[model samples]
Target: MTHAHAARPPRVAAGPAAREPAPGALPAWLAVLWAAALVATLAFAAVGGVHHAAVGVVTGAAFMALGAGMVVLLAPSDRVFVTRLFVGGFLARYVAALFITGAVMIAGLPGLEGGKDYLHWEASGWAVAEAWRSGSPTVHLTDKDPGYYYLVGAVFALTGRVAVAPLLLNGLFGAGAAVVAFFLALQVYDRRRAAVAGYLAAFLPTLLVWSGMVYKDVVLSFFVVACASAAIAISRQVSARSVCALGASLVPLFMIRPDTGVTIVGSAALLVGLTGRRRGSKLAALAVAGGVLLLFLAVLQGAGLGGKMDLLARFPNPLTSVAVARESWANEVGAGSSGLTRYLYGRNLLLAPHLLLAAMVLPFVLPLPGTTGGMMSIGTFLMPGQILWLLLLPGLLAGMAGAVRERAAAGIFLAGLVLAMALGVALAGYFSNPRYLVQGVPLMLVLSAAGIGYLRQRLLLYVSMLLCSVVVFCLYALARGS
Candidate 1:
């Protein structure tokens, strides 16, 4: 019998292959970094003498509560197994916000300030608040963001005009931004990488310094990141809910910075056209976005939203103005720069290598001499502890390379967002400062985290290079300071 039929292969399971377990939550090293940042910032605040110290304390408590509430609402459901991460993130960000509020309050005190720009901001913000309280038009005061003024005014009214009020509000925004960056990176990559990105977003000097200030830069940064996160969600799974989230996020952006809002939409359109899987729907999305932008611009112009400095007038024809503005700024501030900064501020495209170098490095390493004006608003040092950012550069480059290779939709969005910012900065001379690029800092952190993940195999090499970069930056800073 016959047979010696070969024993049938053990019945193969008919179900899908067993999926790999997801990565663990934020790493212990990241927790260490966050704690260090908190201690350092608090020390700085204590030594700096927190102005309105009592107010800062009260505001910090409020922000801590806000941070805790946010964790409950926004912590990712998929990471239920690592639920302690929610607690860690909320605590880290909450403490960071408290210290930041104290520092900003101390630095932003009305009489002891250093920058006219900050003074202007404070006065304008107070006036806006008063006007809102008394029901008057702030249109004549300035052509800047109404949303910021409204918010600042509301906070001032609530807190009885304490300078800490705005600082506290901004602190909350910064903390919320860290949370958003965490989830956003989680969507793009895995948990460990997400932790890296979130840690950087939460503690990065760029965000901490800018977001702690009284300026609108941090608010713009938050909205930009929010819009990017919403866009990423939509890209992963397009739905009415995602679209509405995107639209809702953009509304505040439009109110605060219309040009940036346009740039975001334009970038989003490019992203969908390049990377969207659906052929027909992609085209339709592009058309609709374009139409909406054009209509919005027309409506803004019709409503005289731009006043004398009409944004629409500069559109579709900004190069000439850009050149003029670049020349003027170079004459004003491009004196000692030797590398990309000199060339870029000089608006010299013939030195494209310098442009590339500067574009890649300036966001992290751009130095401000101690004697430089506008120290109060910008800070005594541009990105203090600047050497640390070197750790992320390799990751950023590696991530960008991998993204291009993969033809990832997230990569397209990142490229578009960066390009739009670069172009916008070039086009608007007044907006040419590095601070204007703060909006994209969250994405930059995301890319850097991706870079870390990609280079995990070459861990030693990456660490060595990172250390060398930090050493070099320190040596350079010392030499310059000396």
Candidate 2:
């Protein structure tokens, strides 16, 4: 046996350690470059002396630094803490959004010419309360949404000081939305991807500019993201706890905007059906719970708990009428098909390069400039160039397709719901703007991050990074100049 034994091959022992890039392997030179870029951006903003430009520049730089740190720290970590990433990105985004919003607020503060009247609602609410107390039966008002006013009234009733309360509340909601957005992204992707997505949502200029304003958009966006996040969590595997959260989150959606709430419910139902989890008693219980909630909302609306609820019930009809009226007004204003179409086309063309440039640089830069209302306020039908920016939707769709391919079920579901909602608004003849599409922006970034992850060539990654930097710098410069 020993003489006839076959030659034995040498056995290699397996080790605990796995091959990885050396610590500090990433180019130090790149870090230096990022630092230089941040400094240059701040310098440019300071030199330009645009209103509150220093705040913009500094806040933006801080975001960039934090984002870069996150990227560097997480790049080599094999185990990703999804929650930590989400929280960190949320904090970064919130800080950036808060700073930009403050700048806009200062610019539009009540005392300045053409400045925003932050105190308008507060003053009006007090006036109405005073009138009501004085036995004025006909305390009528044009603004029907009473949620903000009621909250303000309550504050005034308690404190006898109503200054800036409404604006503060709106700012709080906006900041809260930024936090929720981060968690929502984390629920769908790994920590790194979620961080990027959250950062994108938080830093996007449109959201920053609009969130702090006393408007419904911030509240709506918060509820929308919360509802979507909850639904996605339930779809992954319906737990009693998750179901409860989903149900609770829906309440805010209904309260803030009933039409959007309906859309969310419909999306959830579609998701549940597609998931094929119909046989269980738990599922049955969840259905009943959802039904009860809907019934309650209907009852409350009927009883006039919130007049907005009643308005919501008649939304479809009134929305159609508004659309018709808008069209008629456009026609009367000589903004008919030919004129509006030409304008839309021209604006779209003009903005195309800028938007494309923004897309490239946004991923790399921190505290990216918020989308000022200037461009988006220009009606879509009146500006072709503006309509062209809608191409971002297609880009987002492509990114979503990539998510689907990767079997990111949650991402796909959320993205689908967002697309449906956006399409509904658009088809109703409502004009589209980058701000309107901000909710979908995270999914787009997630897809882009996934794509980048798949293409792991160092040279290519660096080249892409360079391109992003250039785009961000150029866009910031242009926005400042404008």
Candidate 3:
């Protein structure tokens, strides 16, 4: 349901030189940067004791030096170079993801104390693998998503009981989501903003750390971004490819997290109805919306919700469900430290706005007073990342404003998606964690990029670094005080 408004050109200026570069060609230096990132990944991996540590260190060292040398040799603003940065940023982010995954595996795996959710999911996967190997392939977990377990099982079936299966899968999916986020921004905004969105999606530490783990958050995030990206594409131009991507993206989302899928589809439909003009586009949107609803019902029934509605019966009041779940999870994960956690420990409709605010800010201001004991806290190791997010918050807001001003339909869709997901997670309660908030990270990143576009690059960089330093100092002081 898009309005027939003309798309606004972005504010960022492209330098003179090759104004009409060949399509699909990027700067060669990006490849070098990507290579460097890979080498950096190997070095990080080696530090985690994954074997070949020496080789990784040597390889990374050489690549870093070479990439550095090329940085001076290459200019920043050739048409080809500027256009290619998005792809390069996407690829290089994966290398960074490798480093994160390696570190997580090194620190948390095989009895170093990690999230219970990880243990449960991994165990379920192991069971699924065993079942598949034995020709049963049936999962008995009443409350879990069978698709995730089966996915893990399939990996085990093919590769045989590898502990790293989930880690690698998470990393790949996370990386793919980052790229898709870039493409999504490109579909709706200018290349400069798209580039910012892509790079932000790649390096968001929360995403990086989650990608390194053996959980469904990253997987869920990938599908969410995929569905959103595909939706944006189809909304703008209904094509076989866009339609296919949209349809395909829904399949996994349905399987992995039907509830989330339902919310996302519903949100998209509303946006379509509000913004779309073409009859064909509207029909296509309706088809997808209806398909997603039916699929969600099927998943629920298959998961045993149809006959008894036992899960629904447990929480007579969904708002209460949200509150209880959030509080319980905080205690379980040691996230009780935050002021927001304390404020949200009890259920009340009056707290709805507060709930949204808490959800939005928790990713940036975490490990507050009550968050001292949980495995998810990671013992304040995430503090710096939190600080970075705080620094970017203003930019994220500005970007959202820019998106709405420049591309109202897409911005509305993103806002609706984020709001709907927040409500869904709150209502569902038990499994709610900030990890689920990762679904909104790409949207925020896109907005942040737009915000960044409004300022001079050098000025923005200096301000960002300054803010970062101050945040780091505050974090250090807080840590010491604690």
Candidate 4:
């Protein structure tokens, strides 16, 4: 017999409240967050020894440009609040980039003592930009993901080699991600709850820090979330807008991170098939989804990964093969986090077999390792969200439970993306570096946001427990130091 589902709540009629939030909420939030980011950017420039007088000017101008784009993408939704979300989220990331720049350049950040990929990308990008400007031969990097460098070079060329310009572009994408989170949450939940999720997407530490960095974090995450969101919309209705959105999102996504792109597309294909209204519509939607996959595979082959893909297929178990590869790569991350990784994965095969179960629970436990900050590493910069993650874990669980009870497809779609990425990271034993987990942070924040409404009294209880945990951790750190 089919199980009973909880009755869904009554939908409210579209009104001014739904169309526009409290008049100045977004604007106020944007003003404060942008000011913070600007202050930090200038401080970082001065402290980090940048001689460019235009740094502050450039930062402000970029925020303005990003704000303009945000309005175009989100304000058109009849929700001026969404445009505000773009500002909050973009500035959060903007502040994050400057913090990282300062830490790496000034504080002798213990975390990234070994290597700083963003600095490398910035330097290389500047070189490429200069070559292009002077009519010199182009520089091509063969060792790494050259696509990101080329993008950085293009931005630097246009802006005359301004530092962190690519990061500003990434912040723009991060802002778009925030807007997408708002709309998706609104679709699945309600306007009020969606607004909460949207703002959470803006202020969450991991979301800000990773998106703020000049690396591939925000761009990679945006496409994945955008693809997943489009996939969910397709599940609701196979429309030209949703189909085109899915294709546009999944194409660049594949070029950026192939596995995550597959997870998103695969999830979409499954979702569309399961939820389509009719046999004809289901077939058509599935066909379009398959077309995107085929196009991505062709691109992969052109990029010289066809043989690797075929070899991956030849594996008796692809997950195991991928895991071994990731484990090897994780070793490169260094010895400090090796203990943490082993503690999570273990020598025994206990964690890997329970992929779905483990993926759902693993992200919460990540904050445990470096909470004391005794051994700083690259993970430390991303670790600002650790305690926040702890604080939100209960709500995340509560939100997931609520979604299950209500049978919310959007929640399932979001939960799917988050868990899929976590599972892949877990299987690969890539626990040492938390950046791999950034792909899921925005969606996790959405879940936590929804859970906030569900936790009426328990919220205070959770906060008290969090404070207790912090006190205990502090005591332990003091004891060790003494």
Q: Which candidate has the highest TM-score of all?
A: 4
Q: Tens digit of lDDT per residue, candidate 4, span 14-131?
A: 9546665466554555678768866886787687556432553475467657665757764575445665566667767767766666665655534552246656777777777888
- Cα shift from native, residue 350, model 4 (Å): 4.4
Please write out the lDDT profile of model 3 over residues 1-482, one tens digit for every residue: 13434465546656623353445754555658667766765666566555444343343344334433443344244334433443454445445445544555555543323467777777777777787677873746425457677777766565555555555566556655666677778777787677678777866776766655566777787788878877776666668987887788888877877777776776666555545556357575676567556444433332334222355554345444444554544464324234443444433236455446544544445443234344434435455566677767667656656667776788767765765665544434422245667666777777667666764455765487557645644543353234
lDDT of 2 by residue, 332-448 (tens): 322422443445444534423333333433322222123323422212112332222232333344456667887666666765665555543332333322344444344444454
TM-score of each: 0.74, 0.53, 0.68, 0.76
* Residues 86-179 of candidate 1: C-alpha lDDT, one tens digit per residue: 3344344444445554545565544222356656666777887788788898897655667777777777776666655676677676666666
lDDT of each: 0.62, 0.47, 0.59, 0.64
Each model's total of backbone clashes: 0, 17, 13, 2
What overall lDDT, based on C-alpha atoms, would model 2 receive against the true structure? 0.47
Better of 3 and 4 by lDDT: 4
Runs in model 2 deviating more than 4 A are: 1-145, 151-165, 279-395, 406-408, 432-482
Range of the 10 consecutive residues with the lowest summed lDDT in candidate 4: 299-308
